[model samples]
Each structure stands twice: as C-alpha cells, then as structure tokens.
Target chain A: MIQWAADVSMLVIGVSLLLSLWRVLIGPSVPDRMAALDAATANVIAGIVVFAIRDDTLDYIDSALVIALLSFVGTVAVAKFLAKGVIIERDSD
Target chain B: MSEILTSLLILTGAFFLLVGTLGLLRFPDVYNRLHSVGKASTLGVVSTLLASVVYFWAQQSTLSVKQLAIVVFLYMSSPVGTHMMARAAHLIGIPLAKETQRDDLKKRRGSVPANE
Candidate 1:
C-alpha cells in the first residue's frame, strides 16, 4: 500500500514539474518566469520529501532544508532586482 | 493505521501540487499566478513534509528534525516570497488581465507612478 501511494504521488509530482517547466519555457514576461521558477522550486522540495519517505531514509531531509533556504533567497534577490533593477544597493545615491 | 494516514497525506499533497502548477500554466496574469502558486504549493509541500515526519517517526522510531525544520522554514518564507514577487511585478508595471474590473492598488496609492 505504501509503495502504491508513493508511485502515484511521484507521477503527480512529475506532471506538476512538467507543467511548471512549460510555463518557464513560454514566458511572456520576466516576473512570470520568476513565479514559475518559485513554483518549480517548491515542487522540487516536495519531490525530495516524497523520495525520502519512499526510500525510508532520513538523509534527504537535509537536502530539502538547504534547497528551501536557497530558493527563498533566490526568490527574494530576483524580486529585489526586478523592483529596483539592482540586487546590490549602494549608499551613495 | 499510521501507514494509511501517511499515504493519504502524501497523496493529498501531490494533488495540491498539481493544482498549483495547473493554475500557474493557465492563469492570465502574473498576480493570479502568484496567488495560485503561493497558496497551493505551500500547502502541498507542507502536507508532504508532515507526512515524511510522521513516516520516519512511525517506521524508524525516531523523529526527523530536518523535515520539520524544512516545513517551518517553508511556511515562513513562501508567503513572503510571493508578496515580494507581486510587489516587484507591480513596480515594473505589469498590467492586469482584461477581465480585471477594479484597480485597488491604484485607488489606494493614487496617481503616484511606479518606481521605474
């Protein structure tokens, strides 16, 4: 039963990933792409967690944590760049 | 019994993830996409993480702090990231869909132009 659930969930995640990929590829604008990327990152984390459960191993959880932090930072930086046109700000304006 | 619960949670999470990505693909505007991805995907990921935490606790007889930490971090950050992205899209003057009826932000902020 556990294996059946995992297999089905994996298929669903795969479909989700593909849909996000399509959005990333056919972006009409930059922010759209960024949003898609953010969604993709979240999906990947979900995938990792599911894989960890299926494998019955706790090690992949660490990778999931790291990816979560990195993706948040990446999203914030990209949003900042989009808003201000520069990720790095200077004191002398 | 616990195994069944874990599987149910994971399957539900996967469903939400699929719904989120579907919204991302079909939404007509960036803001709408943000709304979809932000809410659905966050819930999806959180549910799945909770499942893993439960799974490890039940099967291995030990709690997984890392999975719990990931869930906490994601819940805290995902909404903030979505808000920032929405603000950025607005600052850059991304237009709303034709079906949009009201411009609440413009009404609230008046004629002040975006920071270009």
Candidate 2:
C-alpha cells in the first residue's frame, strides 16, 4: 500500500514539473518568466531528491545540492540585472 | 518501517508540489505565483527530504544526517532566494494584475525599485 503512494507521488511530481514548464513557456513578462524558472528549478530539486531516495543513491543528492546553489545565484543575478541594469556595483563611483 | 514512512512523505511532498506548480501556471501575477511555487514547494521538498532521511536511517546507515542537512539547507534557502527575487521584481515596477485593488508598495516613498 505504501509503495502505491510512492508511485502516485512520482506521477504527481511529474505533472507538477510539467506545469512549471508550461508557466515558464507562457509567462508574459521577464519577471514572470523568471519566477516560473525559479519555480521550475525548485521543482526539479524536489524531484531529484525524491527519485534519488527511491533509488537509494547519494550521487543525485550531491548534484541536487549543486544545482540548488547554482540556480539561486543565477536567479538572483538575472533578477538584479533586470531590475538595476547591473549585478555588481562598486560604491567607489 | 522505512518504506511506509518514506512513501508517505514523498506522497505528501508531491501533493504540495503539484499545487504549487498549478498555482504557478494559474496565478494572475508574478508575486502571487511566487507565493505558490516558492513557499509551498520549499515545504514540499523538506518533507520529501525527511522521507529520505528516514529511509536511510532505518537501514542503520549513518548517512541520514547528510539528507537532513540538505533538507534543512533547501528549506532555509528557498524562501530567501524567492523573496529576494520577488522583491527585486517589485522594485523594478513589474506590472501587477489588472484586478489588484491595493498596492501598498506603490504608496511607499523611496521603495527600492525598476525591472521594466
């Protein structure tokens, strides 16, 4: 019975991932797209961890961590750039 | 013990993720969508990660700590990142939905901003 839940969860996660992708594709503005992309990244992270646990692997978890770090920086960079036209600014000006 | 617990956790996590994604797609504005995807999904991942920790620890493996750590890290970071991104968006003057009746940010002076 519990295994049934595992399978069902996998299906739901898959669908959720798909929905996020859809949002990413159809988002009307840059910020909307950015938000969708961020959400997608989070979805992928969750999916990876769950699947890795199901398969009993530590490798995926490590990569998931890396992805988490990279995605956060990337989103921040893009959003900052879009907002202020710069990612890093020196106060020496 | 591990199987049932892990499966239950994964299932619950997946449910939140599904709703978050749905909210992402259907929400009228970017900030609202962030509430769904960023907040809900972050919680969802933590639950799933806890499931993994339980599964590993049940097998007498000492590696459950690693899973717990990752879960905790994700939980801490996801919302902060999302908030930063959303705040950036709001500052940049991203358009809100037409139906939005109140915009407290607009009423504030010196509110950091411009995305568009």
Candidate 3:
C-alpha cells in the first residue's frame, strides 16, 4: 500500500514539476519566473520525501533539508537583487 | 493502520502540490501566482514531511528530527520568500492583472520608483 502511494505521489510530483518548468520557461516577468522556480524547488523536496518513505531510509532527509535551505536563500537573494539592483547594499547610516 | 495513514497523507500532499502548480501555470499575474504557490506548496510539502515522520516512527519506532526541522524551516522561510518576491516585483513596477481592483500598497506608498 505504501509502495503504491509513493508511486502515485511520484507521478503527481513529476507532473507538477513539468508544469512549473513550463511556467519558468514562459513566465512574462522576473518575479513570475522566480515564483515558478520556487514552486519547483518545493516540488523537488516533496519528491525527495516520497522517495525516502518508499525506500524506507532516513538518508535522503538530509538532502531535503539542504535543498530547502538553499532554495530559500536563492529566492531571497534574487528578490533582493530584483528590488534593489544589488544583493548587498552599503549602509548610509 | 499507520500505512493507511501514511498513504492518505502522501496522496493529500500530492493533490495540493498539483493544485499549486496548476495555479502557478494559469494565474494571470505574478502576485496571483505567488499567492497560489506560496500557500499551497508550503502546505503540500509540510504534509508530506509529516507523513515521513509518521512513517519513520511507525516502522522503526524512532522519531525523525530532520523531517521536523525541515517542517519548521519551511514554515518560516516560504512566506518570507514569497513576500520578498512580491515586494520586489512591485518595486520593479510589474503591472497587475486587469481583475485587480485595488493596490493599497501603491496607494499608500504613492509610486515606488522602478529600481531596475
């Protein structure tokens, strides 16, 4: 039963990843692409979780944690750059 | 019993993830896409992570701290990332959808200069 569930969930995650990839490709603006990329990152994490459960191993959980951290950092950096035109602003104060 | 619960949670998470990606693809504006992906994907991922915790605990009788840490980290970061993206888009003067009736931020801030 768990195996079947993992397979089905993997299929769903695959479809969602493709959809997110489509958005990333054709997004009209920077934020659109960023949002799609962010969603895709989350989908990847979900996939990793399902894989871990299916294999009955705790090894992949570390990778999931790392990916989540990196994606968040990437998103924030890109957003900051988009808004301010620079990642690190000089303190005027 | 635990297998049944795990399967149900995984299916539920997958459903939400599909819905979120669908919204990301179809939404007309960046803000709309952010709104959809931000909330839906976070919930979806969280649910799946919870399922992993449940699975590990049921099968091995050992609690998984990594999954719980991921859940906490995601809950904290997803919203912040979404907010930053939306603000950045706004600051760069990305136009809204035709259906958007009001932008209180624009009204109050009175025109954020496009930085780029």
Number of the top DockQ candidate: 1
User: Could you tell me every candidate's TM-score relative to the true structure?
Assistant: 0.95, 0.89, 0.96
| Model 1 misplacement above 4 A | B111-113
Q: What are the per-model DockQ values?
A: 0.90, 0.66, 0.88
Interface RMSD (Å) of candidate 1: 0.7
Largest TM-score belongs to which candidate? Answer: 3
lDDT of 1 at A40: 92
On residues B36-95, what C-alpha lDDT tens digit does candidate 3 reach at each position? 989999999999999999999999999999999999999999999999999999888899
Model 2, TM vs. native: 0.89
lDDT of 2: 0.77
Question: Higher lDDT: candidate 2 or 3?
Answer: 3
- The DockQ for candidate 3, computed on C-alphas, is 0.88
Every model: Cα RMSD to truth: 1.4, 2.4, 1.7
**Please, what are the lDDT tens digits per residue for candidate 2 over residues A3-87?**
5766688788888888888887888777778778877777787788877776666668887778878887887788778767889
Chain A vs. true chain A, TM-score per model, equals 0.93, 0.88, 0.96
In the range B11-74, model 2's lDDT, one tens digit per residue, is 8888888878888888888889888877788778778888877777775575656667777777
Residue-by-residue lDDT tens digits, candidate 3, A1-93: 999999999999999999999999999999999999999999999999999999999999999999999999999999999988789887793
Winner on lDDT between 1 and 2 is 1
With candidate 2 superimposed using the best TM-score fit, by how many Å does residue B29's alpha carbon deviate from the native? 0.9
- State in Å the error of residue B15, model 3: 0.5
Docking class of 3: high
DockQ of 1: 0.90
